[model samples]
Structures are given as structure tokens and as C-alpha cells.
Target: MVKSGQVSRQAGNNLASVMSRSVAKDVYTAIIEFVTNSYDADALIVKVQYNSIDDTLIIEDDGTGMDQEGIRNFYRIGDSEKIRNPFTAKGRRKIGKFGIGTTLLEYLAERYVMETWKDGKKITVREKFEGMGKGKGPEAVIEDDPGHISGTKITCRGTRFSKTGLDISALKKVLEWQVPCLPDFTVYVNRKPVSKRNLAASCIEYAFDEVIKDLGNVSGSIFYNKNDSEPLKATGIFIYVFGRSVGNPQGFYHLLPPSTVNRVVGMISADGLDDEISFDRGGFKQDSVKYHAVKKFISGVLESIIQDITYSKQKEPPRDKTDEIKEGIAIALKSAESELNKSLVNADGNINKNHPYRLELLLDEEIPWISRIDPKNNVIYINAYNPQLVVYSSKTNPTSALNVVFLTLAINALAEDQVGANNGNSDLFKRFAQTRMEVAKRLFSNFTPIGHYLKQQQGNDEQKAIAVSDVRLNPYRLYSIEDAAKLFGRDIDAVTRLYMAGTLRSCVKRRGIDRFRQEDILSCMSKIEGYIEIGSVSDILFPSDHESEGAAKHVLVNKIIDSRGNKPEYLKNVGSIAPLYFVKANNVEEFKRWYNGVE
Candidate 1:
């Protein structure tokens, strides 16, 4: 029941020429091919050693060695039994289909020695090649090596390694990427073990598999580098046929964009792709329909995985220390309130029940002060005019603004407690005021109007730089009134009123411009009850007396006339010097209507 095919002598000679001409593209690739052969042989441990002194590379493995018939089959180029039966006797898929791997030794060295033992029999073979370009084959000799055990050892001499010898570190990385996940199996180079555990630790992996109608089972893992700065050197999806790696890492050009190439690495195994692979077993045949189908599927899967990663990152909460800050401030506020309440009492010796101490937080468009503690009313008011508070409150979680409120209340409570202890000593009060202002500046530095306003002057190099440096040193440093106005979104006159009220303590006057301390601004911010409209008398009305005494009265009367215009219904004499008009201050809606009709 045996059948055989024969080739002519000329054809055999031509085949030898083809084998001699074909060689591996690189030394590392040639080495990978030989190692992959050992894996197909069901090797448990593969040892590789390079001798720089002699330029020799030795690869040995503890696998099922070949018999005499197997040796003959190995020598037959392009006629491997693996092509007919794609799986080994152990049921493991084979990586080498063509017998070309055996001929790859010619590309690595000029001379080589191979020894193997099987079934109590041993064989030692030696080969010497003239040169690759000569089209001449290796001269071989066979002998018995009875001392050899049940394994295979290949020693390649006169290797074409670089002048400094092999780069063991780089070679180890290549092996780690090319080798599949083999349980209880390890590869050692120069007695050092190469491990995949480190690579796995630095990646986020996801497992995926899809069954295509003509492609059998397609399965693989996608890995994204957790740290982009230190990515794997050979990053891409490594394609495997059977249990061995075939071709260089692929899927870079097709799977993802160029920007993400360094951050992604993967491995895919498609057993049915064996038939569609090239003769050299390096890659799939481009014209094969099965190749395109598998590529398309892998591309789709990779795109989905990338989208999932992006979505997860977007949903992750931003890292911050605001929660810790808020908690500390809350504790401080409670302690300050408790200390201040002890000293605050009525004349009857009982704790003040009518004017109970409380903290009030408010947001007003017209408020000019940062904060105020009223001992008479026992109320602590904080202004929402602070730019820091506005920015923080607008966040998805308004913890930043809440922190400002707690801190401001604590500062005000402490100042009130200090004032009660001092009993109105001017010197002691000044010291207490100084201390309170310093504390407020430090606590609400980021929330201050001046702080936010100065940030907007980024175009002014000298001023912005000085402000930044001062803030870094002490957040409560004095700023000019104009800067404060810009920060509070108020006019200069309103800010000046705060300065005159003594709530805003002046630090120093420079070039006739007063520089108010940040702490003083916060203290005076609460003292501002209402805004006064200040201007010249003529500006307030169209017609007014030029004389000083009656100038104010005439301005007021003209204001009323201008407000009413020349409406005949409201005027008794249309063009007379004295006109009668009716007004209603109680009806706010009616007053607004008349005001709208005014000149």
C-alpha cells in the first residue's frame, strides 16, 4: 500500500541551487526559525548559547530526536511531511510547513555540527558551506555519537555575528514576543531565563475570539501599554499559525492609527490560515481571500477595543485633594464657632438668645466685600463675588466653593473671639486685625477677586510675574484698587468706599495709589451694605442751577422732570417753568413704568 514520487537528477540539482540561494533576511530571524522547529518537536526547555570568542552559536533542546528516516526527510528540501499533516504526533500544531528551516543554517554560519539520539541509536552530522553566493551546497559527513542522549544539539561555527557579539538583552525581548504561551516551558540564553511575566505586568490585556465561516477559529489577545513612555520595542499584533509565530509583528498599518502604534501590542492565532500562508511561512499570501477576511475581522475587533479604552478613561474621576481640604476646613470652622460662642453673652449673664451666632453664605451681583463678622447681629456673611468661589461652584461637584465657605467662616469666628478677649485695646485690636487679615489671605488666596483679576493680566509680563511670585510666597499680599475692581467686577468708586470704611486695611500708598491688603479686602467685603451712585450734579440731570447752595435741589427736581419727560397726562403746564407731576413710590411696577418713560 506504499506509493512514491520521483525527481530527475537535473531537477534535484536545480532544487539544491534554489535552497542555497534562499536565506533568512536577518540573523535574529534565522535563529527564531530554528527555535520554532524545536517547539514543533514538543521541546520542554530550549537552551541557546553564543560564544563571542569563536563567533559560534549553539542551540540545544530536550525534545524527541529524529530517527534515520526522519533525518532523510529533513534533508529533502520543500518536501516536509508537515505540509501533508499540519499537526505533530503529540497533537500540537506544527509551525514549519516547508523544509526551508533546515536550510536556514547556511545563512547563519559557514560550518555547523548537528547531533541527535533516538531509540538507543545516535547520529552526528557535520556540514561545510563554501559561500552562499556560490550556489554550492554544504559538504556533509555522518557518524555515530553513542554518548549523545535523547535530544538534539546544533553548533553553528564561524557565524556572521556583529563585531561586539550578539546583543543578549535585545534578543531576549524578540524571543519573548515571538514565542507563544507555553505552560511549564522556558527558554534560556547564556544561562539567563527569558520571562513574559514582566511584559504582561506592564500591559492591559483583553481576550477575544471570533469564528468565521471559512476561517475556522480566530482567537487572540489585545494589549495596551499602561505606560506610553516605556512601550515595548516591537509593538504590534504578532500573527501565529498553529502554535508558532509566523512573520514579523503585523497589523500596525491596518489595525490602528500611527499615533497609537507604540502603545498597542497583540497576538492572534488562526489555525486554518496554514494553507493561505506563503511558502516561506513568514506571512499570508496577499492574493488569498482568506487572508483579507481575517485581516478585516482583526481590524474591526481592534477598533472596538480602542473605543472601549477611551470611554473608560473619560468616565474616570479626576485625581484631586479637594475632599481632604474641605474636611479639614469644616473641622476648623466648628472649633472656631465653639470658642467664639463661649465669650459672647448678654448683660443678664445668659448666652445671647436673640442674636444667636450663625454663618450666612450668599451670592450677590452687587456685593463688594469678601466676608464680614458682625458681633452685634452675631452673623458671619461671605460674598459670592469672589471669583474663586464662582469657578469652583461651576464644577460638576462644587466642593471647591464649599471649602472656601468653611474656611472663611473659621477665620471670621476666630477674629470675633479674639476681639472679645481684647476688650477694645487699639494696639491689641490692630494686632488681631493683622493676624486675621493674614489668615484670610492665606485661606482664600485662590478665591480672592484680586487673585482672579491678576490672573487675567497674563499679557503684562512684569506685573503678572511679580503677582505670581508674591502669591506663591504669601497669598494675602496687597494689590492695587484697580486690580481689585477688575477681580470683583465692580467700579473703582465702590472699591474706594470699602477702603474708607476701614474694613479694607491699607498696606502702603505708592505713586498716590493705595495698595490694600488682601485680608483687609475680605474683612471690609462684609461691611459694604449698599452701593452709592457718585457723579457730578449736571451729569445727574439735563437742567440744573449753576449756584452751589441750590445746585443739589435743582438737580433733584430736574431728575424728576427728565424721568417723566414731557408727557401731557402727567404735566399740568406743558411748557411752563413750574409743572405739576404725580409720583407713586409704593407701587414698584408703576414707578418702573414712569422711569422707563423718562428722558
Candidate 2:
């Protein structure tokens, strides 16, 4: 005969005896777990104390505490009275659902002690860990308690964390986002009260109030912080089920543009999402309908908030491009003017008042060139209307790029004059190379933001440079342009650009062919080896452009050339030798900052 009987599911003794794997993830989680229990008890204030020096953690709260039976349920595995009673006696919605008990305190340390008082009764439980069967079960002792007030306190010694050292600031943020959004409830870390942090320095908020089709009422607020702070930035919106925080989605980074990533933070609470809450409570069940509803709803609103803020910024009044370009030109010229005036350009290889170096920025883009030089006049003509330059000026460091344009072209002009008079590249080691190198160094150091970084790195790099230069056995060594190009992993055009840009000087004439000394080329390579942050010639070579009335369609294609008027040597490999700017200065990003001075 077949027999029918009722069946029930149960967690094994060992399985239910431990805290949920999710709740025991870290000490912070443990703090959150305990704080949450306090909150569920209708505690208005919870204090969390962590003594890194002593490796101790203590959580104390004043609320309706547990009696002896409540203490028994606390140690019981897979059995939470919270599941049966949706609300506490005070009518506050319950936060704890999982009944996995005891292991969390052990996770904190090898030993645990918990105490509580309720209705003139006191119970204290102490648990010690040993090998499975050898471990002592939780020991509860009753004490005299006549005080009307009740509360709970959990204390642990020899805590499991020290490296993190219990960052109270981070814990403050966690308490704000991880716990329920309650105005009356407050959390304190190490006696310092946790408060809303960095939320008011240029902040905006978006609030929502609505009911999901099946997930019950959902309400919350999303905040945007303009402060550039690591601690202030929220990873994402925290999801709360009933009064318990479930997960942080981490969608804030991807939803907003890079400019606003991590600036957004929020919370979404649904009254009925118990089934959707993940086992660990770090997040939610991906396949659950209620979870999907919460996520989609939160993502949609968050994205809208980001778009609104981004759009407002775009709506601000924009400055005239021409005035901006002119201002950049003026600043760049002023920065290099004094040094350029002292440059070795006169007949005596020194300053010449009559022929002082000057930069002439012109909006005349009738010619397709970025720069032009007149030997008669000390003025260097920069086509402020160059189309490609206009594109670069819109970036962070237009003035720095412009300074490079003026200095490189000026050096090339000087090199053409002095080096042209001498037939041998060795003459540079004999005459102008040192002066030219010194002049290049001064001009770069004084003008570009990138130059400052190079100044810092030069000591380290220049020392190693001689070692690289030492690889050349002969002082009279000669390398054809193509040979030098191959050595530096560049193309013929790129090497030629460097030579004409005054970054590399030609050594001597062999069979009517121009050759460069390894030392000259080596120094240039060493300075730029790791400092190369430029790409196309247009990036640094050209940085000005102006629109001509009625000729908006006329786009000038930049073809950079030296003062001698020859095309820039094709750095077909390095993309037009633009990175061969004087001294191969520091990181370009820092240069941009120095040039812009955003602060």
C-alpha cells in the first residue's frame, strides 16, 4: 500500500548555523548587518565603534532589546521570526529575512559576546570557536535587569581586519546609502556621528514617487554632486526591499558621460521585493520580475537626470572662437618674446635690436601654410586662420601648442641661417649646437606647460641620454636622414621634420647628401623617448584658425614647412613629426593643464 505524508524543507545543522555568505563578505558588511538589526529594532541611534589599535569592534544601540526566547531565536539557524512577523512590535517594517545565525560574529573574530535587556530581564550570550564538534554552543546567562530602558550590544576582539583600518568616512557613506532613508535615525562611527557628506556643494536632486505594477510603492531621490571627491562619489543607486538595502547597481559610471561619472548617487525602495532580494543581499536576483522592474525604472530616471544636467552645461553662453584664438596667440607670444629677443640670430650670434624676433599672427588663410618667415623682418607669420589649427585651439592647451609652433619654427629659421653658413654638421659640436641647444632649452622651459614636466624629467633623462649617445663610437659619426629615421623607428619625412624643426641638426655634406651626427640625433631622441604625447603635426605644429566671411566652406589643409619653405620631412611613421617639439617636454596632459590653468 502507498502512503502519503506531508514534507517540509530544512537547512542542515551545519548550513543554517552560519551567517549568509553575503552578510559575512567584509567587516563593513558585518557593521551594516548589525546596524540594520538595530534599525529593525526601532533604534533611533546606533553607535559603531572600531578600535584598529586593539583589533576590536563594538556596536551598541538603545532599543527594545531581546529577551531569553529572542536570544534563542538569534542563535537558531534557518529560522527568523522576522519571516513570520513582517513588522516589529513598534510597527516598523522588518529588514532581516535570512535566519542564518551565529557565524557572522565568528567571522569578525574567533570569539563573540552579545548582550541585551528587555522587560526587567538581561541575557548575555558568549560563543567560542573550535574544531566543529569541539566548539562550544552559544552560552546564555541571565542577569539582574531592573532598569526600564532596553538595548543591545555586540563586542568582538581580535577583529579580522586591520589593513583597511576601519575608514570611518567610508562607513559614514555606507550608513547613509546602505541603511533605510530615515530622517530620525542616525548612525555614528567611533563616536563621530555619520552625516550626509558632500551633498550640498553645488548639488541637484531628482525625486520619484510612484507604484510599480506589482512591486508595491517605490520612492527615492537621486543626487548629483559637482564636487570632485573620491569619497563623495557614489558607485550607483542602492536598492532597498521593504526597509532593507539589497544592492548597489554600479550603473552611475556607465549612465553618465565621463565628465559626470560617479557624481550620481541615489536609492530606490520597493515594499514588496522579498523574492527578488539576492541570497547575499549585495544585489538582487537578475531574473526576478520585481528586480527587473526596479532596475529598469531606476536606470531610466537616472539617465534622464544626467541628460538634463549635461544639457544645462551645453546651454551656457559660448565665447567667440576668434577672440579666444587671439587671446591664446597674445599669451603665447608674450611668454616666448623675452627669450626669443635674446636668441642667437644677429650677425654677432647674439641679440640684435634691429632684428628682434617677433611673432605675427594673421587671420589670412589665403595660403594653405601654417607658418611663414621673412629674413628681412624678424616677424614669423602664423596663419591664425589655418583650418587644422582651429580644431586644436578648441582643445585644452591652445597656447602651449602655439608656443611650440613659434619656438620650433624660430629655431628652424635660426638653424637654416647658422647651419647653412657652415658646410659641416661637426660645426654644431664646434659652434652653434651648444648655443642652439641652450636656446631651445630656455625657450621650451619658459613657454610650454609640457616644458615644466620636461624640466623635472630632464635631469633623469639627460643623464641616461649620454649613455645612449655613448653607443656611437665615433664623434664624427655620420647618419643619412633615412638611417637616423630607421634608428628612431620613424619615416624619412619624420626625421627630416625633426632636422628642420631644429630638434635635429644636419652634421655635414657627404657627396652633396645631408648627414646628421648621431649625438645630435641621439639627444633629441632621448628627450622625447617617453615624453612623446603628440601625434599629428597639426596637434602641435598648427594651433590657430580663423573663419573668413562668406568663405566658411574654405578649409585649409595644413602642410607644415620650415622657415626655408620646404615641406616638413614626412614622419610617415610618427605621423608628421609633430611630436618632435623642442625638448620633448613632460606629459602633454599636464602641459594642457598648465596652459589652461583650469584651477
Candidate 3:
């Protein structure tokens, strides 16, 4: 039997060892876990009060307060009572893997007290850092002390808070995307509840049609309200507006859907290693289910909203080879111009003029590229040393608003230079200028009408007009040149032309053909445009073909008279009537032979 004083000294040493181990690790993460534990408790309101005078942090939660036994189990260093699935009624799952988070407070505080009540029963736990190290049992330190409240309140002394002002705002920003909203739970730091007005809020709707196996049961719509609402269950999208749910699917814009995000799934194993092209477009792929879900969501949203105004399939009408080629060229010119103009603005908005950067662009693939900007000086430079495939936020300071303006300008200038190199007159530059003005015009023109429609539909409330951040574009299913070619069985050049033509319509007016002409024509064209939004000349050509001086066909095809002197060969292949004429061939030879012989 050891002496009583010796046993007490040994226990005190053990307690001190626990505190020392936890303090050696990340204290900031421990602070985060304390707040997250409140979330798991289904506590809507978590108030973090830092007493500067006392150098203490008081974290109090209105969650189901713990009983004496519950507190003993939950707060112990080696206790695994709370380490379970998160989808419980109380939603308890320990995010702190090491179970040493409670000890972290002991490192920061000289003395700590936890007072709690549950089911009309109250308990208090108090500890002096040095005393605990002197071999006092955990229960020996706790007692039925007075000043206990209905909820749990943890008071830590000897904390180092406010040598500088507390960054509650920044802390709230990180928490917004992580916490779930139950309408009852609200988190407040320094007596202030986290609000959306302080953070950059984007409520994006994500549509996940199905989930692949092996990723666990992580499928659910996540609506992220400004106050930390859970994502919508059906869409699986984390939506954030002014920080509240403004309805879903019906009220908000989608950022990503399921089909697009799936492409990023799958990891490269050691056996999957190849030659130098490992980082190129086809070389690497994502193996993670979570990444796939996110990628699909982003691609879906961008495809639906970003429109091309110049080429309307119904109004322009798809024709034979020459017309298709011409249309493709026109569309390509417009897209290049639109993209360049935006890049130029981005460059000019930020960065110093003298800052030198190189640009290495591979125009072979259509991928987003990056550009650098110094926002303070409003100068832009190109970066050539770093070979990045996609255009995204800058590495140094990604959140700068000037990054977009700077990138847009640099890219626009580069595009202009590349496209204008061959043409002395700088047709490409001219096209870029025209496309910029056109998009601007279209954007402004639709604003009033759209506002009126929105006012009628969702009311003129600013909240309703406010766009929610959602997964709007899905890249996997995006209609690219390759996809067009595969669908039409055409060559790459032909498909490129089709893409150009399609993009042209994005710059056009949204009004119907009747707005341009006296009467609408060819009912079939109207149906196609209505369903597909691809426009063509078939709407205006059929009825007026014979009446006009053949100027319409010439303007449509950008070509001279055909051998028949009535209709161009290309225009004939567009409608249902031409489907029978262009018979499918076994190979390119047969296709060329058949098309060349068309009268």
C-alpha cells in the first residue's frame, strides 16, 4: 500500500500529462470541435462569450444538457461513448477523433468549470490544472455545485483571447458551410449570431440523381442557410443566399446536377501510371465519390444558363457541308470575341502594369485557363512559367474580386493576338469587340422584362431576386464539339463549325421570329426552337423563299447561286425533306461521292 500523498501525487502527474499532450497538438482545431460538438447536440444556438478581463472563453449551448453520468462519459479522454453515427435524434457523433479535445481547455486555462442540467437534474465539474495533475480523480473534482444552469456552460480560465480583436466573423465564415440548420440551432460568437450579411453567400442547388456504392450513405440535399441550415434533402445542394432557405429547386438557381459531377470519380492506381501525359486531359481521373458528385453539380448549372445568342438552330436551319462550315466559322468568331473581351477586363482591373508574367496556352483543348492580377495597382500580367490547364482563381490571393477582371482582360488580349495574327485587318479583334457589345446589349435588354416576370412570379422582394448559389453547370454532360461530332457522325472540323453556329445565337435577341418578321413560318421550326432552343432560318425561309429575290438564302449560307439557281444544295439538307436525300455511307469516300454529286 502506497502512502496517500504518493498516490495523489501520481494522479496529479497523470492529469498534467494528458493536458500537456493535447496542448502540444492543434488548439485551434480543438476550439472548432467544441463548437461542432454543440452542432451534434442539435443545438440551434451556441453562444461563445469571451471574457477579456478574465482571459476566459465561455461556450454555452441550449442543447440537451448532459447529466452527471453523461458528462463523465462524454468528456473523458479515453471515453468512446459518443463516437458513433451522426444521424441520431440528438445527432451526436464525435468529430474529435483523438478524444483529447476536453484536455485542450486544460492547457489554455489554469482552472475550468463545467456546470450542466438535464431532466431537472444538475451537476458541476471543476478542475484546477495543477490540482488535476496532483492525482485527483475526475469525479473527485466534480460536485453538485451551485450556479448550475439548465444548459451546459464551460468556463475556461487563463485563455489567450483578444491580444487582437477576436475574429468571430472569419470563424462564422468557416462554420456556414459546415453546420446544419434545424431552425432551433443558432451559433453566436461574442454575443453575435452568425449572419449572412458578413459572409459571401452563394446558395447553389445540386441535383444528384443517384449515388454510387462504396462512398457510404452520404446522399442527401444539403441546404446551407445563412445561419447554417442543412442542404435540401432532395437536391443534395448546399444553398446559401442572405443565409436562409428561399425555397428550393423552384426559388433558386442550380449550380451543379448529378450527371456532370460524376466524371471526376476514380483514382489512378500505381498500375495505372503511364508516360509523360499523366496530368493532361485524358491522363488522370478522380476516384472519389464525393469529388464526382461535386463536379457533376457544377457542370450542369453552367450549361443551362450561359447562352449563345448568334446561332438559333430553328431560325438558321442546318444545311449541307458549305453552309455548316460557314455557320461554324461565324460562331467561332463570336465565341472568341466574347471570351477575349471578358479576359481583357479582368486583366485591367487588377495588378501592376510593370509586373511581368508569361502565358503558356494550349489551344488544342477547350479548357479554362488562369491569369494573374495585382488588384492594388490595377495591373495585369500573363504567367507562362506555370503550366496550369484550367482558368481559376489565382494561387496567391484567390478571393480578390480583381482576379476575374484581370484574368478576363489578359485572356481577351491573348485571344485577339492569336486570332488576329493571320488577318491583317484584325477581323478577330473586330469580332471580339462586336460580341462584347452584343452580350452587354442582350443582358440589359432582357433585364427589364425579366425583372417584371420575376416580380410577378416571386414578388419584387429583393430577397426573391437574390440568386442562390447552386450547382448550375455539369461539365460531364456539357455539349462540346466532340459530343456534337459523335452525335452527327461528322468530322472534327464540321463539328467545330456546328459548335460555332450554336454559340452565335447566345448573342442574339430572345424575342420570337415574329419580332423580326411580319409573320412566322414553317410550324416545325417553331417546335424545334421551343423544345431545343436551337434556331434556324427554316422559320422565315419556307413561306418567303419564292417571294423574295433569293437574298434570304444567300444571307443564310454566305454563298453565291447554286447550279439550279433556285435553292442552295446545303439548305436542302436541313429539313425533314432532305433526310431521305443524304443516304448514310459506309465511309468518308462514299459520303464525299454522294454529296459532291447532289444537284
Candidate 4:
């Protein structure tokens, strides 16, 4: 048992304990709090200095300084005059609200000295904190000081610095992002002024009002680097609330593709968001409905801008010859697919069956081949720009065009057989070249008589001379070893070896280069059957191969009959309608016998 003694009751506030508890989480927050307070006082110039060697931080501002009464009001916790009156004496908007700016100083250092002058009188105050925790109130001392400047100066000793110490560059960036458009306001780090350059000259502004409900007015500008100069250090659309930035400049989470992002930078301001700003002022209150509404509106507008830029880029003319060629190939392939499918049939006279081909064609001007067959994909890539194809198309009729398609299909079929085997044989390409040449020779021989007949029908010397000269004197009518290699889709060295081995003949020599005429090439090809063994029926057929030579001829005769669908009597004289190479028939029963026979 103990008797209760008379206790002296004392009522006091633990200012240090309160201030320590109010410590900011980061150095940047602590620094910005003081700078913002300066802005509230209508500061025109704010200077910050960090001395790593002495572990000290100092901030000096030329603003309306505090008097004795103002100093007492500033030391009050959680109560600020700015909260009652949100504007300054000079009619400028105020940033400080809860009188926590002094508390934030505890986060930067253990001790702080503040001095100010007002109405021709100067006063100084010093406060020291033990540590950042619940403890005794901070030790404070107040005194008069001889000072002439009419502003505020704060020095924080025993300051805490990050692992990299002071980053002046980062501080400058923060200042720029915070007060980029502030008029008559400037900040300096280590005596170097921080300023933001106006991009108005290179940018297009979009002024929008109340794009989203309760989001207030929205305005921004999209800027482009005309010379493709170095990319902006901070890219993306920066978001501002009132006049202060809410976060680091963002690229809208990198939504746009690099093509548009690299050329563009932007800034957006949303009015009335200051009320919804986060406590730390780092960003908006994410859960707030107004914040989400603002974000959604901004995102949609940025997406539209990106689409416009992308569409404009696409509208520009082709960048190079390669691009033009690619476009041409795409158009030609689409047209060819539409036309070729109407008449295309398989060796068994079935339409698009058993061989199911898909074609992919690309034009590569550097490829040393008039056309190449990528049999793995059943693609027949052609060089329509080839000198021979250009000349031939100019003078030929529809039948000649059909013959060219037939030759391409024949080569593709033969190549597909070899590619499907996957045997990895080096001589397979040579076999393919031999098959191409053999089929081309047969088609040319069958087509030549028709050309001569057409020439005779002209019955004019001028027309005859032009035709003869084109066949004889035109350089496009013949091929050098390199050109022949291109036409046959073989290596130049292999084709040259064929020339040396007496398997090919040169029609003439122009400029010391051996050139083979179309007629001479066809003659040489006719003799190749004796030198190279034909392994597949495709090696003989012009457009497609059958199970046997008889089957191929049957399909050709049937195709001819189908072409004359309007004339049913054409089948009565089958021999007259048949090509010269096909077996003649005097009656339908005889034709059926040949068509039905096994290999």
C-alpha cells in the first residue's frame, strides 16, 4: 500500500516527438516541401545547395519572409493560415496547407537553422531533434539577428544523403517537372539555374474542355523533333495538376509503337486535380473516380494521335526501289492468283487436287535468277523485270503468255518432287535446271510455228522486217552464260561448264561475251535428253506431270475439248483438234482407249 502524494500536473506538447513522426519518407519529398513553401510565399528565385563533405543542405529563397507572429504560426502543427486562405497577399496561389513544411525538415537533418527578415526587422530560429522516433519535443531557440535580406534561408546540418550523394542533374529535372510553366519563378542547384525550354515552335497544341465529366479542362501539345535530334531525356505525356506536376513524365505506359514514340513528346494539364492529388504530391489518388476518368480520357486522346501519325507515315511515298518492287509483287501475285485458278488443273485432269499448292512470291532484284522455285512452299517467284520477259510480253499474244505460265508451273512441279525427298543431294539443282530447259524447248518449238503464221498474216514488208529484226538483232532475244543461268535458275559456273562440255552452244559473241540465241538454246535443250537421264514425268511435261507420258497427253486433249465447250462437234474430229505431239484419233472410241490405258 502506498499513500498518493500531491502531484504537480504539467501540460506541454512534445514538438520534437511530433516533428520526428512527421519525417518524410525520402530526401526528395523533404526538399520539395520547403521549395513549395517558398512558392507559397511568392518566391521569385529559390537556391538549394548540398555540401557532401560537410553533410549539410541549405535552401535560400527571396520571398516574403515571416515576422515574429508569422514564425509562431509556422511552428504550429497541423494548422496553417494557407488552409483558411488559399491565396497569398500578392494574389498568387499558395501551395502549403497543413503547416507541415517545418516538420518535413526533420527528415533531412538532425538540426536546422532558419532566418528571416520582415518589416526592417530580422529574426532567427534553431531547432534540434534527437532522432526520428517518439521522444522529447525538439529543442528550440529564438533570437534577433542582424540581416538585410527580406527573405528566408534554411540550413540543415548532419544531413542524410543517398548512396550516390547529391545528384544535381536529378534535382534540376525535378525542378523542371515541378514548375515548368511557372512565370517569374526560377530554381537553382549549386548556382546553376534550372529552366525549361518551350517547345511551342515545334509542337501542335490541342485544347480540350471537360473531355471527361468532373475532370475540368484538358490541354496539351504534341511535339516532334524535326531533325531527329537526340531523343528527349524525359519522353511521354507529362500530367500536371493545376500548375504542379503529379508524377514523372510518362510515355502513357509506352502504349505507342516506337515509330511514333521516337518522334513525339507531349505534356497534358488537367485542371482541378490538385484537390485529388496524393498526400506526397507524387501522383493522383488512384482510387478516386475523377482520377481514373482523367486517365481514361488522356489515354484515348493519345491513342488517336498515335493512329494519325502512323497513318500519315504510311501515306508517304515508297522509301526505296525495294519497297516499290515489293508492292508490285504483292499486286501481281493477287492478280495472278485470280486468273490462274480458273484454268489450273492437275495431271489427272482433277481441278486443284492431289497437289494442293500455295504460292508465295517476292521480288528481289539482286537474285541472279529470272525466277526461282522454292519448292518447300510451292512458290514460283518471278522476275517480271527480266529483259527477256519484258521483250517477250511486249510482242507476244495470249497463247505465248499461257506458254510462259506453263513453263513456270512445270519447273515448280519438278523441283517440288526433289525437295520433298529431303535427300540433301548436291546434284539435285542440276537435275532441276535440266528439266526446266527440256520443257522450255518443247513449248518454244510448239509455239514458234504459230508466231511465223501470225507474221505471214501481217503481209507487210515493214511488219515482217520488224519481226525478223526483233528475233535476230534484239539483245533481249538471246542470253549470255550469266543470263542463261538466271533463266534456268542454275549457278553461272555450272552453266558455263555445260557450255565447255559441248552440251550447250553459243549463237554469237558480243563484247567478248558468249551469247546464246533463243533458237540455239532450244536446239541445245532438245539434245539434252541423251546426256541427262529424266527421272520424273514432270521432267518431260510442259505445265504438269502425269503418272505416265500417255496420261499427260490424255489430259491435254481433254483440256482442249473443255476449252471449246460451246462447240460440241469439235470432239467429232479429235485428231484435228489435238496438238501435234498427242496421239491422233479417228473416233471417240479410239481416243477413249488411249486415255484409259495403264502406264
Candidate that would win on lDDT? 2
User: For residues 133-157, what per-residue lDDT tens digits would candidate 4 score against the true structure?
Assistant: 5445434445555457679999999
Clashes of each: 3, 9, 110, 2
Each prediction's TM-score versus the true structure: 0.50, 0.50, 0.38, 0.48
Q: On a 0 to 100 scale, what is the lDDT of residue 446 in model 1?
A: 63
* Cand. 3 Cα-lDDT: 0.39
Instruction: Extract clashing residue pairs from model 2.
Output: 385-546, 425-507, 425-508, 454-586, 493-569, 493-570, 493-571, 494-570, 494-571
Model-by-model lDDT, in order? 0.58, 0.59, 0.39, 0.55
Give the runs in model 4 whose Cα sits over 4 Å from its true position: 1-25, 133-147, 200-212, 224-227, 258-264, 318-599
What does each candidate score in C-alpha RMSD?
23.6, 23.3, 20.9, 27.5
In the range 127-244, model 1's lDDT, one tens digit per residue, is 7776434533444445566666677889999986646468888888878877755765678899888776345333555555678888888887767775654666667788877666
- Candidate 2 C-alpha error for residue 88, in Å: 2.9
Error of 4 at 298 (Å): 0.6
Who is ahead in lDDT, 1 or 3? 1
**lDDT of the structure predicted as candidate 1:** 0.58
